[model samples]
Target: MTFRIGSGYDVHALVHDVSRKLILGGVTVPFDKVLRGHSDADVLVHSVCDAILGAAGLGDIGRHFPDSDPLYKDISSLILLKRCANILNEAGYAIENIDTTVFAQAPKLEPYKDEMSHKIASTIEISPESVNVKATTTEGLGFEGRGEGIAAHAVVLIRKISKKSG
Candidate 1:
């Protein structure tokens, strides 16, 4: 059996719009500013997707879901995460576990960590115990701390599925 580990990081600027929900790992985190991106811009999910692809020896998110593609216009990032899992499964890789952290100074996320974990696990067709979502602040030091943007980091472990168990 072969195992691989990969990590990904993502950041998006917060826009002035209040209409868009601040989604992280498919869970809505209420905030006045929404992330700016071609997609729904769930930074946590995006980071996880990248991590999965990385572990699978696939290219990054931009290679799979380009911003220039209209097919992904304003699409939910959870959907993208699902696709990533499918890709890995088709490549004979199984998800071992995923850990992630969201960097934000506002709209405290301690309460939503469990829900985020559940959402991410469901999206990838994995057990909730295999997913861990955490949140932190930069102590008002950077763009995330200053409330200008949000960021997330994710690490994933994937193992090649043995033919007997696959």
Candidate 2:
């Protein structure tokens, strides 16, 4: 079997909406504003999805699921992640591990890191130990530090299926 590594990065602007929900790692977060996007705007999950797709040598999420498509309007990112997993399976690849980092200046995220890792692992059908989630501040150096948006980066490793599995 062979191994491949891929990395992905994503960012979304934060918008004001008292009622909009902040969903990350499939967990709801209490916040004053939520990300603005055609989908549910889970930056973390989106990056992870892209990493898996890249590792499998597939095109990006935009090519596979365009925001212009009405079917994906307001869709949850978890659903998108699941579809990416299916694509990997069809390509005879399985996730070996994933590492992710989120950038945000406000609303300390350390408390939720573990749950985030678990959610990502469950979506990819990998063990929690195979996934790592971290949060950091840009030290007021970028848009993320300015609190204009949230960004996520993910690196993933995938293993090709053996001949027997194929």
Per-model TM-score, in order, reads: 0.95, 0.95
Query: For candidate 2, what's the RMSD?
Result: 1.9
Distance (Å) between predicted and true CA of 136, model 2? 0.3
Summarize candidate 2's per-residue lDDT along 105-161 as a digit string, tens digits: 866888888998888788778899999999999999899888899999999999998
How do the residues 1-30 of candidate 1 rate in per-residue lDDT, one tens digit apiece? Answer: 799998999999988876687888898887
Instruction: List the lowest-lDDT window of 10 residues for candidate 2.
Output: 157-166
Least lDDT summed over 10 consecutive residues: which range in candidate 1? 157-166
Most accurate candidate by lDDT: 1
Q: How many residue pairs clash in each candidate?
A: 0, 0
Off-target runs (Cα >4 Å) in candidate 1 are 162-166
